[model samples]
Target: MLAQIAEKASDPAGRKIHPREVERVFGALLASSEFWRVVALSRLPVETVAEIIKALIDVGLAVQENGALRLTPGGNARARARGIVPLIERTCPGCTGRGIDLRPYAELLDQFKELVQNRPNAILEYDQGYVTPETTVARLALLAAKGDLQDKELIILGDDDLVSIAAALSGLPRRVVVLEIDPRLTDFIQTLAGTHHLAIEVYRQDLRRRLPAELCRQFDTFLTDPPETIPALELFLTRGLAALKGPCCAGYFGLTYAESSLAEWLTIQQILAGKLKVVVTDIIHNFNEYVNWDYLLESVRKDLSFVQVSPRANWYFSSMYRIETLADYDQENRDRENLALYPGENLS
Candidate 1:
C-alpha cells in the first residue's frame, strides 16, 4: 500500500517524505544485513535507516532498548511474509547493487577513454576535478543502462569531468546543456563541440548566484559532481532538482565517502528526501576515480617538505547516486532564489 501511514512521518529536516520513499527504505533494510544497511543508506538521499527502524517497531516486529533494536516474535514472521532472506543474498555479479548491470556498455566506455587526454585537468581554486576516463564512461553506461539516454534532454550542473562531451559523442541523448563557472571549461567544451560537431551547449554560470530563469523545469535529467561538503552538495542538488521537468525526471551525481562521513551523507539524504521529495533508484559504488589533487603542493607549498608526493595510483573514489523526483519539485523554494549553501561564495 505504498507504506501509507495514518500520520505522515517526516525526516530530520522536518519536511514530509513521500510514502514511496518510505517503501524503498523498508525494501533496502530487508534486502541487506545491518552492515550493508549502513552502507546502502549512505548512498540514498533519505534518513532511511531511521524510517526502517520505525516501521519495524510500528508493526510489532522489533523493539528498541538502550539504543539497540531487538526483533520480536513477529519479526521472523514478518520477514517470512515479506520473503526477505534470513541472511544476506549474493549480490548481483554485474551492477552489484539493486540497479541493472551496465557491463555491456564497454564500447562507450572505450570511446570515453580515447578522449581522456584531451579532457581538462583539475583546477584547484574552483575545486574543479576530473575522474578517470573509464569511470566517466561508466557513469554514462549506467545512465544508458537505466533507460535515461536514447533521446532524453540532459543537463550538467558542473562538468569538470567533461562527461557532457562524451555523452554528446554517444549520439544517444537529445540535448546536452551545461552550467559551469570556469570560463576555461566552457571554452574547452565549446571547442570540442565545434570540432566534433556535437550538439553540446555550454553556459557560464557562477552558482553563487541564482540559476537562470529558463533552466527551471527544462530538462529530462541532470548530472553533477559537486564539492564534497554538505552545503555544496545541497546547492548543486537544489539547482539540478529545480531544472528537472516532472516526477519522472532523474539526476546523477557522485559523493566520496573519504571526504564525507556517514553524518554528512544523512544531511544530504535529508535534503533530497524531506525537502526535495526525491527517491534514490540506484547507487553504484566506487563509480568515479579521481586523479591526485596534491600536485598543487609541488607548485606552491614549497615551504613544506615534498615527502608526501602526489599519488600516482588512483585513490579518490565516489559513489554514483541516481535519484528520481518522487513528488512535485519544490517551486516555492526556487522562486526565493536565495542560496545558503556556501558562505565563501557571493550570494544573489
Candidate 2:
C-alpha cells in the first residue's frame, strides 16, 4: 500500500505536486481524513491550503463541485503525462521560483518596467503598436497558405540577431539553414536545439564573404537581417542573391533620411535588377518608439523610384520591410497597378 501511495504521490496530473511539495502534502493527506487535517500536518495555515486548492483547480487538476474535491478530466490525463511530476522539482535558474525574472538584463529590464508601468496596454518590440507575436505568426501562416514557401530550401543568415531568433522559432518553413558569424552564437543555438530536441542546422560562416559553392543556387528562399550599414547591407543582398536558386524574400530596417539607407536600397535594386523581382515591400512600425521617423521619411523621399515599382509597400516609418520577388526584371508593371492603387502614405 505504501508503494502504491508512493507511485500515486509522484503521478503528475494525479496529485499535480512537485516531488518535494508532494512529499509534504502526501504526508499530510495520509495523516488526516479532513482537508484541514492535511493542512495542519503540512504546517500550513488553513488559508494557505485553500489557496493551493484554488491553484490546483486553475491547473485543471482538482475541481470543487458540491463542496467536494474531485479530479478533473485533465487531472486524470496528467497522471499519464509521464516525467512532468519530476520536472516540477527542477527549478529554472533564470526565474528561480518566480514565473519571470529580468535580472540578467538589468538595464533593459528596468527600461521595460518603466515603459509598461504607466501604459500597461501599450504594445512594444518588433511589431508596431497593433501587431503582436501571434499576429506575426498568423501572417507567416498566410504566406504558407499562399504557397510562398512551398518545398523551398530556406537559408537564414545571421542567427545571433533578434530577427534570426524570431525566424528560428516561427517554424514557418519547409526546412531552415542558419548561418551565423559568431561561433559562440552557433554553439548557443546548438545547445538550445539539443535541449528542445529540435532539428535545426547552424553553420559558422561570415556572410560578408562569398558563399560556398555548394550553397550557391541551393536555396529557393533567402531571409536576412544584416547589420544596418551600407557596406554590410550590400554584402548580404548581393552575396545572398548570388546564393539563391530563384527569387527570394528579404527584410531590412530602412531609414527615410539617411543617405546610406538610400544608397543601400538603390544598390540592391541595381544588383538584383536582372535576376530578382521585388514582390512585397512593407514598413513595420515600432511600438516601443525606438524608430527614427525623420530619417525614415527622408530616405523614402530619396528612393521613391524603387518604391513605385514595389507591388505592395507599407509605411511603418520606423519598422521593417518584407520584400519579395519573382525572376529579375528591369521594369515589370505586374505590381505597378496595385502600387498605383495605394500610393505611399506620408510619414511626415
Candidate 3:
C-alpha cells in the first residue's frame, strides 16, 4: 500500500506524506483530546502540513468524520508502521504544553525568510544556535500580536538567531540593542543595521562581565538565546533581566530539554520563581528551530552518526520562556567564582 502511494506522487516528501512527516501530523491528532474532533496545528511548518493533510485524506490515513479529521484503520496501521504509535510517549517538545494553531503566522513566513537570508548560522564555542528565519519573525509577530513589541525598547542578550534584525526591520520596536560575545556577530549585525538603516545597536560584551550602565534597566523587553547549562543560563538570563525596565517588564529566552536535563531546568526555574520573583507568564513550546546546529549538536547528543541520510527533521527545538517582573528586582552581585559560566576561562 505504501509502495502504491509512493508511486502516485512525484513529490511524496514535498507533500508531507513521507515517513518522517507521519509523526508530526498523526502525532498532533493523537495528542488532541477526544472531545476536540477538530484540532488546530502547531510546531510543523504550515505550508508543509497543508499538503500532508490532503495526502493523509487521500491515502485513507485520515478521513472527514463529523467535520473533523479521524484516522482510518489504515491510518492507524501507517502510524504504527512509522513507529509513531505511542505518539504521546515522547511528548511534542514543540507544542507539548501550550496549544493554539500558529496557522495565521504562516502567511508572513516567506517574507520574513527573504529578509534574513544573508545572516550566518550558529557558532558552537559561542554556544549559539538560531531558529529558522520564519520562526524568528513568527516570534516577533507573536510578541507584537500579544501587545508586547510595539514601540518597545528591546535588548537582545545574545542574537545568534539575529531576531533583533527582524524586529528592527518590522519597525515595531522603537529600539533594538544586542549584547553579543562573538565579535564576528557584532560586526555582521552592525553591517546589516547600517545597510538596512535599522535601529539596531550592537555591543561586544562577554556575559561574565558587569553589564553596561547604559544597558541596565533600559528596555521594555529582553530577548536571548543563551547557553542551556545551569550556571550559564543563570548568568545570561540575569543579564537579560537586568536590561529590562523595572516592574511588568518582560524577558524572552530559549531553553532546550534535548541538551539540558530536567534537573537543570528545575534549578533554573526555581531561580526565576524564587530568587528572581518574576512570574513565568508563558512557556511557548518548541518555538525555536536550529537547522544548522547538527554539526555542533552531534558532539553533545552523539546520536547523529546513526542517521545514514542527512536529517530532514527540525529535531533541535527550543521552548520560548516569557517572564514578567512582578516587583522591583535587584541584579545579582556575583563575585569571581560565579563568572565561570561564560564561554571563556577565568583569569587572575
Candidate 4:
C-alpha cells in the first residue's frame, strides 16, 4: 500500500518521511499535473515532495511528463479505491490565499518594487532569499491591519528581504532598525534611508554575538525570517524576544514544512510557549513566498538528485507566525549571554 512506499521514501539523511505526507503527495498529483502545484498542494518541503515522487515512480504509480507529475492508470485506481480525491480549492482567489487583499496596498507595492529593483542578489553564504515585492508589502499591510505598525518601534533581525525599507516607506512606524550581518545590505539600507529621509537606523552586526545592550527591550515589535533549524529558530526568536519592550509586545517569524517536519514544528511551538512564553496568535500558511534562489542547483539540489524536474516557477514558501508576549517572562528568558548554544548553528 501507500504506507509501504512512504516507508521506502527516505531523505538523503536516511530519515523516513511520514506515511501521511506520502498520501498527501499522491493526492496532490491527482489534483494537478504541474510539478510545483503538487509541491504547493502537498504543503510539504520541496525535497520531501521530490522524494515521494521518486518513490511513486519506482512503484509504477506516477511518472514525470514534461516536468509535471501524472498518475498512472493503476495509481488512479488505487487512489480511487482508497477514496482519495482531488482537494477542493476553498481558499479565496481574491486574496491569493493570504486571507487579505493587496488592492489597498497597491501604491506601497509599486513603491517597494521601484526601491528594490537594484537590491543585492541572494548570496549562498547568507542562505539569502527574499519574498516578492508584493509579499513584502502584504506583510506590512497585515501588520498595519493588526494595529502593530502605527507609531510602533520595530526591529528586523535580518534584512535580506529589506523589510526595514518597506516599513520605512509605509511611514507608519515611529522608527525602524535593521541588524544585518551583510555589509552590502546594511550599506544599501543606510543609503536608501538617507535619500528618502526616512526614520530608520541600520547596523551591521552578526546575530551570533550578544545583541547590543542598547537595542534590548527597546522595540514594540520584531520580525525575522530565520533558518528553519531548531537552533536557528531559537536564536532568532530569542534575540527578537530580547528586543521587545516587555509584555503585550509581538514578534513575527517564518517557518516552513519544506525543511522541517510536523514533529519539529510541535517542538518549536513548545519552545515558543514553554521557553519563550509567547502565545501564538496566528499562523497563515503560504503567507510568505520566497523568490527562487540561484544557488539551489549548487546548494539544495546537490543532495536531491531524485528531484529530476527543474522548478519552472518560484515554489518555495513559509508560513507567517504572529506571537505575543503575555508577561515579562520572555524578556527575562531571552536575556542570555549566549544565543548560539549549538555547534555549527547557521540560519542562512
Clashes of each: 1, 13, 0, 2
Local distance difference test, candidate 3: 0.66
Residue range 165-231, candidate 4, lDDT tens digits: 9999989999899999888899889988899887788879777776888998899999999867787
What TM-score does model 3 achieve against the real structure? 0.68
Off by over 4 Å in 4: 11-16, 65-67, 302-306, 332-348
Q: For residues 1-348, write the lDDT of model 3, one tens digit per residue.
A: 444444433342243245454456576656542212111232443233434555667777766553345578888877777666434435455543335345555545664576567766666667666777767776786677667799899888888888888888777898889888888789888987897687888899887887888878788988877777777777777888877878988888887755554456788889988877788888877667666564543443232122222333455677888888876675663433445654454654
Query: TM-score for model 1?
Result: 0.65
lDDT of 3 at 71: 73
Give the Cα-based TM-score of candidate 4 against the true structure.
0.91
What's each prediction's TM-score? 0.65, 0.40, 0.68, 0.91
Ranking by TM-score: 4, 3, 1, 2
* Top candidate (TM-score): 4
Q: List RMSD in Å for every model shown.
A: 11.5, 23.2, 11.9, 2.9
Worst 10 residues of 4 by lDDT: 334-343
Give the higher-lDDT candidate: 1 or 3. 1
Tally clashing residue pairs in candidate 2.
Answer: 13
Tally clashing residue pairs in candidate 4: 2
Candidates 2 and 3 compared by TM-score, better number: 3
Residue-wise lDDT of candidate 2 within 114-152, one digit each (tens)? 322322121111111222332223333333444545455
* Preferred candidate (TM-score higher): 3 or 4: 4
